[model samples]
Target: MTALPLTEAARGATPTSSRVAAVTRLHLARRINVLVVPLIITAVVFVVTIVIQVAIQRATAGGSTAADYAAGARLNPAIAWAQTGYFVALGVSTVASTFPLAASLGTTRRDFALGTTLAHLLTSLYLTAVFTALLGLELLTDHWFGGFYVFDVGLLGAGDPATFAATIAVSSLLCLSIGSVFGAAWLRFGPRGPLAISLATVLVLAVVLLVAVPSFDALTTAFRPWWLVVGAAALIVLSVGGTFAFLRRASVR
Candidate 1:
C-alpha cells in the first residue's frame, strides 16, 4: 500500500501520545550531535586533565615530598563545567533546527514541546549515568592513570560518589532548562529577542547579588541540596511552559 502523509499517519495513530513519540524519535535519530558530541568533549577534557596530573606527578617523582605530591595531585572540576556549554548548544540547536522540521511535519506545538522536553530529560539522565559510571571507574582505578584526581575533586565530591552523581544530574537539568528557555525566546522573538532576554537576566541576577551580598553567608547556608532540587524543578517547569507558550504562537520561518 502507498504510505500516508505524516499528518495523516499521525491522525491514524494513537493521536497526541504517538505524535509526541514521533517527534521524540525524530530528535533521537540525531542523538550523535545532541548527546555524543558533548560526551566526547567531556571525555577528552577528562583525559587531558588526567594527562596533566600525571605529567605533574612525574615531574616531581624523584625526591618529591608528600606535600608536593598532594599539591600536584589537585584537580580542578572545570572540565565538567565545560560540558554545560555543550548542553546549552544542544538546546539552542534543537530549537533553531528541529522546531521548523517538526512544524513542517504537521506536529502540534504542544507535542513538539513535550517531545523536546522528554528528550532533554532522558538525555540528561543518560549523561548523568555515564558520568557516574566514569566517576566510579576513576575511583576504582585510583583516579584512572597514576592517582590523578580529575573526577575526585572537592568541587564534585571529594570522594563521595553519590554526591558527585547528584550534583552532575541536577546541574545538567538546570543547564538544559536554561538553554531551552534561551532557544524558545529566540524561536518566538527572533535574534534580538534572545539577546534582550539574556541582558535582562544578567541585570536581574546582578541586582539580586547586590541585594544579597550583605547576607551572602546566611544565604549560602540556607541554600541547601533541597533548595537546589526545588530550583531545578521550578526551572524545568518554567522552561517547558515558556517553550510551549512561545512555539504555540511561533511561525515556521
Candidate 2:
C-alpha cells in the first residue's frame, strides 16, 4: 500500500496538536500540586496543634498542660503569617532549583523561575491574609468552635499586633532574600545546590540567633514597626532584583 500523501499528513496533525494540548493541561495540573501539597501539610499541622492545645487546656484546668508550657504559648495568629512567609520563601527556592517539568512546554527556564517565585509571593500573601482574617473573626465575634485556650493563645492580644506584624514582615523579607539566592544557586547546580544553601542558611541563622537571643531582652525595647517595615522593604527589593538578574543570565544560556 502507498503511504499517505502530504494532505493526509496535515489531517493527521490534528491529533498530535490535541495531544499536545492535553499534555500541557496535565503539566499545569501537576504544577498546581506543588502549591497544594504544601498547603495541605501546613493546614494539617496547624489543626493538630490547635487540637492538642485545646485537649491539654481541658485536661489541666484553665491554665495549660506541661506540654503547652514547654511549647510556649499556643500558636499566635501573627506568627502564622511569619511562618507562611518563610515556607513560601523556601518553596520558591526549592522550585527554582528544579527544572520545568517538560521541555515541550517551550517556556524558557527564566519564565519558569519567575513563575515559581511569583507563586511563592502570591501563596504567602493569600495564606497570611486568611490567617489574619480568621483571627479577626474570632476576636470580633463571641461564638467560636474551640475552648477558652483558643481565645487566649490564638489571638494576637493587645500589645502583640505591632510586634507580631514586625516579626512577620522581617521574617518574610529575610526568607525571600535568602530563598531567592539559594534558589538561583540550586538552579545553577541542581541537587548539591540545595544542600549548600541549606547549610548556609542554617549557619547564618545560627549566628543571628546567637547574637539576637543574648540581646533580645534589651533589644525588644528598641524594636519598632518602622524598623521592621524598612528592613523588609530593603530585603524584598534585593531579593526580587537579584532573582531577575539571575534569570536574565540564565536566559542567555
Candidate 3:
C-alpha cells in the first residue's frame, strides 16, 4: 500500500475523540487473554483459597478454629497474589505484540499510548469490582462459605471494601504499567531493552534503599495506605511517559 501523506492520513483517520477508543478496541481484540484469563485466574484463586481455608479449619479441629486461623493468618490466606505475574505478563505481551499492529493500522503513537492506558484502567476497574463483589459475598455469608474464609482474609482487607478495592486497583495498574513499559522497551530496542531497564531500576532502587536505611524505622512507623496509591500513581505516570518516549521515535514496520 502506498503511504498516505501526513495531511491525508490525518484527514482520513478516525476523529480525535474516537481514535483512542479505536486503539483500545484494537487491544481488546485479544479479549480472551487480556480480559477473560485474569477472571479465570480469579476463579481458580477463589476455589484454591477456599480449599486451603477449609483444610486449615479441619486441621485445627481440636482447638477453636477461629483462634487457630487467626494465629496462622501470618501465612497470607488470600492467595490472590497469583494474579500478579499474570497481569505483568499481560502488559508485556499486549504492548509487544499490539504496538506494531496498531501502528500498521494507522494508529498514532499517542493514540496507542492513551488507548493502552485506557484499556488498563478499564481492566483494573473490572477486576477490582469483581473482587469487591466476591468479597461482599464472603462477608454476607458470615465467612462460612463451605466453612472457610474465602475472601475476608487480612491480605484482602479483612472485609474492608475500600481498602480491598484500592489494593486491587493499585496492584493491577502497577503490574500492567510495569509490563507495558518493558514491552515498549523491547519494541524500541530489541531484547536488550528490558534488560537495560531492569538493571537501571534495580540500581536506582538499591541506591534509594541504601540511602533510606537510617530512616527505615520512621518510615515504617509513618506508613499509611495512601502511600501505596501515591507511589503506584507516580510509577504509572513514569511508565506511560517512558512508553510514549520509546514509541514516539520508533521506526516500527
Which candidate tops TM-score? 3
Candidate 2 TM-score, C-alpha based: 0.56
Q: Which rank order by lDDT, best down to worst?
A: 3, 1, 2
lDDT for each residue of candidate 3 in 146-175, tens digit (9 for 90 to 100): 545656667767768988888888888889
C-alpha local distance difference test of each model: 0.76, 0.51, 0.79
In model 2, the runs with Cα more than 4 Å from the true position are 1-35, 62-94, 97-104, 108-114, 140-143, 148-180, 195-218, 245-253
For model 2, state the Cα shift of residue 65 in Å. Answer: 14
**Candidate 2 minimal-lDDT segment of 10 residues:** 1-10
Instruction: List ranges where model 3 is wrong by over 4 Å.
Output: 1-13, 74-78
Tens digit of lDDT per residue, candidate 2, span 1-253?
1111134454355454343443334323454444465456556655766677567656667565555653454444533553555565564544463333422344344444455455555545554555455455655553144432232353334324444344444555456555766566555565576687678768989999998998998899988757756866776776666565655544221
lDDT of 2 at 209: 95
Per residue, candidate 1 scores C-alpha lDDT tens digits across 1-253 of 1121366555566567777777777777796886688778987887788678777777777878865675545558766778878888888777768888887777777888888888787778888888888788988886675677776777676768788888788777777777777888888888876898789879989999999999999998888667767877887787778778888777787
lDDT of model 1, residue 112: 84
Q: Candidate 1 vs candidate 2: which has greater lDDT?
A: 1
Clash count, one per candidate: 0, 0, 0
True lDDT of residue 156, candidate 2 = 39
Per-candidate TM-score against the hidden true structure: 0.87, 0.56, 0.90
